[model samples]
Target: MAFTGRDKKWLKGPRAVALLAAGAAVVLGLATGGTVTQAAPAKPKPTHMQVQLLALNDFHGNLAPNPATSSSGNVNGTPAGGAEFLATKLEQLRAAAKAQGQETATVAAGDLIGASPLLSAAFHDEPTIEAMNEMGLDATSVGNHEFDEGYKELLRMQKGGCLDDGDGQNNQNSCPDPKSRFKGADFDYLSANVFYENTEKTLLAPYTVKKFKDGQKVAFIGMTLENTPNIVTKSGVEGLAFKDEVDTANALVPKLRKEGIEAIVVLLHEGGLPADPRAFNSCPGISGPITDIAKNLDPAIDTIISGHTHQAYNCSINDPAGKPRLVTSASSFGKIVTEVRLSIDLATKDVDRLNTLANNHIVTRDVPKDRQLTELITKYQKLVAPIESKVIGHITTPTVVRTADDAGESPLGNLIADAQLADTSTVTNGKTPVVAFMNPGGIRSDLVATGGAVTFGSAFTVQPFNNYLVSMDMTGTQIKALLEQQFSGVNQAANKVLQVAGITYTYNPAAAPGSKVVAGSIKIAGQPLVDGTTYRIVTNNFLSDGGDGFPAFTTATDKFFGGLDIDAFASYLSAHDPYTPGPTDRISITS
Candidate 1:
């Protein structure tokens, strides 16, 4: 739902304009004594409604730009993103639409909050919700990261209130704003497919209907990936059922049509991957789950705004009826915005499908920052400054990034795994961890350094889930089974190779999915793995409970819970003084 600043029907309509006394043109050629008179301009009545939807996705509370070294800091080699620039871009896009007599709504496909920078996540993302309000965001879908903190917290994000746990524990300083209370999202968070298992009620409103000036209506249905439960922590999605994305949206199409809303758009939080030569505005080739999902979608859906793959692509994948329907995604971290325009027939009350247009716009920083957003950011910067600027450690000149090599290992991933192992091995309460396994998905951002200095805030942004470390005992045979799960069963479609601190293994990427790991390639501490020997392994709770399609950890024994992963990382960084990116050679690849 794009937010039109005012009720568009009231702007310049016949009912709102004053009729001239003369009604038509007045002439100075009077019969006797003539007086010059001018007639008011005739207001042209618009024949149809032009609706513009300005959209963004996967913002992830990026109030500021990434460090120059971080890939997410910019787009297409140009400095882009940051809330100030994003707000300016949105305003510019909306203004352009308004000048054309088009109504506009700013929408998002979700990931607006959750794993955010310290400035936003420090106060439970209240600042982001406030920032969105100022940016005139009308609606967004509920993404998987929105559930990182649990559903109750997500409800709090929508309904607005003060969190009872504002004691500055676990990186949370909720409701620390001067107002002392959060007002929640001014925008709607549509959750069409997510529901409560008990009563079968949707977690949030299923869809939002936007009515235009000419009495035409459009519906925006939002949904996350159906496999959200498998990716998120169990407690976050506890008692909530995520139905198939296709079925949930299809069920709502007829419901909307019955109410005379034929122009439908889906703000789906799932997306596809663009093939080689991926450009921000056009797709050379497209494949992934979204390609199939879009094909199965009902023809009644006019447009689809997608995210979660964090890739930028604009395309028109065909609907079931074989007519091309617009499908678009703006890349993550507020770097891009998609402007979708549709011409709705005044007589038919539906979209002129052939006349629809869509494109992705990069939020370049050349424009002046929006004043309101600047003020909001400056205020939060002051509040978060103390914690954000505290130098906790130093890093090498070249930063350690989250980019993984062909063998599925990253320098940042290895660093985090080492930190976990270091944290667990020093504990006196349980057996020292023989290996530390980190699911690649948990490594959020890169370890970028400014002047070779890394701060607590930067670390928080890198690992913001605040997931606790859990250690469990398993035999070498069980460990082998766990490693196999990375490229088999649930992970075959999208494998997640674990980063390790105490082991090295080789695998054949082109081999059959279930047999990728080379025989006897796994080794722990330079020793060949023995099937009967027991070993202690450490990982975050999300992975231990099988998050990100890795479920083998569920059967381990003697689990030991430790402190926060962020703490371990920060401590490790400080203890090491000048941290360097790991060799990233823990995992090997065989042709």
Candidate 2:
């Protein structure tokens, strides 16, 4: 059923201090006025319950300020992000909320562990989780990228595992103990709809209930995209299935309600926030999914924190009951923190009918760094310092990370795709790479041109994720099918075709929606591509698993080694020095 919107009850009542002390006393089996009982104080109806939810998403383990943007923007519009500065910001936010006499819960929308800078990736995501624990994050929803290493590795990261250092030793020299590979987090990981196929129950708990002062209880439900199986390595989630978000929430809410939890929030790894609402610049109508989800979700759901497509928007829409449901998403990369204050009535013990607030704070690094978080990050930072600061490759031209309206493809993306295709082709003994496609979303940052000198550090900053290269054999018709997926909707977001190497195609925007690619529109090495001919193509593991809805790559045969795709791109850049894009070298799409 289509989602229908409703009016929300805006916050309007006078500010009142929460009776958290009373709530705590009740939980502790103490008396406030009448009697001390063993019956949990009859749920101890709260007089007032105020909660502060601090959220961040897509922090791809950027422990240090990327040298690429050092010359320009800083975290808080200052210089750049250093652990010290970011720690300070997180701590300040938490402390300030506490000072205001409000309970706080720090959370994230995932993409925090995988594709991380060298420090965490090298150690198999431990460093990042440890850093997160230090930052006081309470819970997180899994992002697609979190499954980068597949499910077994994700489990290892969660329950701890072992690593080798090429010395054939049982453990890496740094971590002699197997248990040291992944130090588990202090917070919870929620995945409501994801489950083992046979059981049909959540692979993980659907949500976690957190208790606070004045007997106030809150529930958090987590969900990734329903098509997670399509975007994750088949082996990673071998026996798992991802159910629809709405269905998942509908099933779980009743369970939480039964547990005496009335206030509920959803931390979904999906997204809808756009960089510019009016401009619709890169991803137009990016908020579609999140908005639709919010409108249709049961009224029991009070708020939704989202991520994945890293645009930021702060607004509130209503549920089916005409009661306001607050929705907030902070800008990615630790650049912003979304703070939501949910006020509950002291008398009714329900969400305050007239006074709840949603605030999206831009986490500027301009503030003093938090010492506690800084110190914790430093322990890992020192161990990761050498690798994080190392130079791996260089770029001569700007590399052109993004493709504009009139533009056909991006050089940086082409370089990465070509590297993957070439790398796999050679390793497989001269297997011709007919085409290579790289999802635009995989290229995290733009290939920035720093007037004078350029280094590998800059390149790492541009392509930070650890997706690997996988080659598949597909017919030309399948390739066309893939292209169609990128341009399906008229007012779609991120519509640009995935950038490619070793092939080119023209798309007709004026044509009817489904018939965009005209006859003979696609080419391979300047020759018309025959629909029936089988061709070997190369794409990152992310797409091979159908990320961003590019399912064609998953249909390919003959997949190969699964090493980091970014490393391959870096190698290509290193091998080809003085890189430059000619007028028509990378891509050309005509009207």
Candidate 3:
């Protein structure tokens, strides 16, 4: 049905007619000398119901306010983000929708935990889950980060208790209270496309049906990108298989429709980037995998809420039947929340596509902090103070930032690569790694020294993934292939450049993808790399297992797992106090 600007007329039902007749009788009695009486008119049954969906995505557990310098934490150049502020905004939005006679549900597109800030990650992300439960999250799809600790650990997150293995190394089991236990998330975690290899069944509930008091039902189908295994650590998805997003979603649509659930919303963890960076609320020329997925979705699906790319945009995409459907995403780190309004037709039990609208609202820091969230943060902060405040080392200058250059090299990346190289230089097997590489995505933040001293929290924030350094042997030719892989195949669109140490190379960006690196340019300490010569290389486990589309590492031999990446970096900083930023001459790019 088409959305019109004209106000809908409310028709009186049988109950209202009966009430008016009763009132008329009273009026007649009053005219016949009986005392006059007044009766209130019966409230009319609404012909259609408005459902308000408050959606957020990629909230990587920033319970406390993020630093002002953090790009993701800012909204419209204002210091924003923090669970407290996010909670207040959600409450306000819910209240406003309620006032307008609309039912509201707060949902997320996932990445609610994993790779979180020091406060939440210190305790294995339990604090973040607890905070989300308090904020009244109704449901969320499983993002790739949810599989960071592996599927078993993900199950523990859903059905909670203390981590059975008790991560003694990182003190992940160090609860705020000695007797405290982590209570699982109160909301449902749906994963429609992920299936068990053994049983050939979905890993989690395919979808959840939300029923309103007025008999309006909407089905929420949740799933991550089908290529989850390629992005996450291989072990995390050992026994699981991710099916095609379009196929899985289309297959479920008929079942939901047969069950009388006409209104459907897909909570997808995969998202797209908007063409215009400034258009946070409007989708003008949006492009990415989400665009193709939305176009192929069944017409029965009403809206799609997505994440993973961590960009924001609200758009109306056409379904297979050429029907418009709302698709939206809120930027990462709880900085923005997308409010979607849907008008469901009572007779058809389907969304009135024309009447649907969505907008992204910033979670501004100007609002009052939520008291309960404040208390939660305070509790966790106090418990984490000792670890967070411990001095890790010192930085000689503030210029050592995480910002990558055109060639993908950065001072901080160089430092991390150096640290990994040093840590793997002398392993238990006595094999030394001659070169090291770090993924750009792993370097989460910059080493901004506060008064020249770097705190443990700062170090942890820089390398928050907790990936282990893996040393392996690869031929010089494979190493060159690895560099070329950065610009081709899966990396072509993402362009995930690798950070290097103990090696240097020059490349021409204008050259063909597989032939970007100049011949005879790859070198180690001024010596040209020989094609057949084998060399030991060190990198994080994520990359060693072919994560981030770096498949060249998967062919390496003589695997040796070393210390945690953060520890190696911290140790390097501690040993090299007053450390200066390294040169960014590792990778030279020529047009």
Model 2 lDDT per residue over 1-591, tens place:
111121011111111111111112111111112121112211312466678788878777666555435321243334545555666677776786687677888888777766566655655667667777778888888776677767666665556556555421211123423444556767777788887787867766678877888788888888877866554455666788888888788777788778877888899888775434322111223346776787778888877888876555554455667554556666556666676667766555556523455445555656877666566556665655444444444456655555533545665666666677667422454566667888877677776646523444466666766556666678988888887877775324546567777777676766665577767767887888888988878777668877777777677776653446766666676676556643435454456
lDDT (10s digit) by residue, model 3, range 1-591: 221222011111110000011112111111111222323421223666778899999997888887766576687687878999999999998897787778898899989987677788777788999999999999999998888778988887888877654533444544557777887889999999999996769888888989986788999999887877755556678899899999999999989989999999999999987766556755556778998998898888888999988787766666777655677899989998888777788888888765555667789989999999999999988888767777778888964798988888999999999999888423645678889999998888788788899988888878876666778899998998899999999988777889999899988888988999889889986789998999989899879979889899999987765556887898899889989996799999877
Candidate 2 worst ten-residue window by lDDT? 6-15
lDDT of 1 by residue, 532-552 (tens): 999988898878877777777
Q: Tell me the lDDT of model 2 at 39.
A: 20
Evaluate model 1: give its lDDT.
Answer: 0.79
The lDDT for every candidate, in the order shown, is 0.79, 0.63, 0.79
Best by TM-score: 3
Candidate 2 to native Cα RMSD, angstroms = 10.6
Say which prediction, candidate 2 or candidate 3, comes out ahead on TM-score: 3
- In model 3, the number of clashes is 0
Worst 10 residues of 3 by lDDT: 10-19
> For all the candidates, what are their Cα RMSDs to the real structure?
13.5, 10.6, 12.6
User: Of 2 and 3, which scores higher on lDDT?
Assistant: 3
For each candidate, how many residue pairs have backbone atoms clashing (under 3 Å)? 3, 13, 0
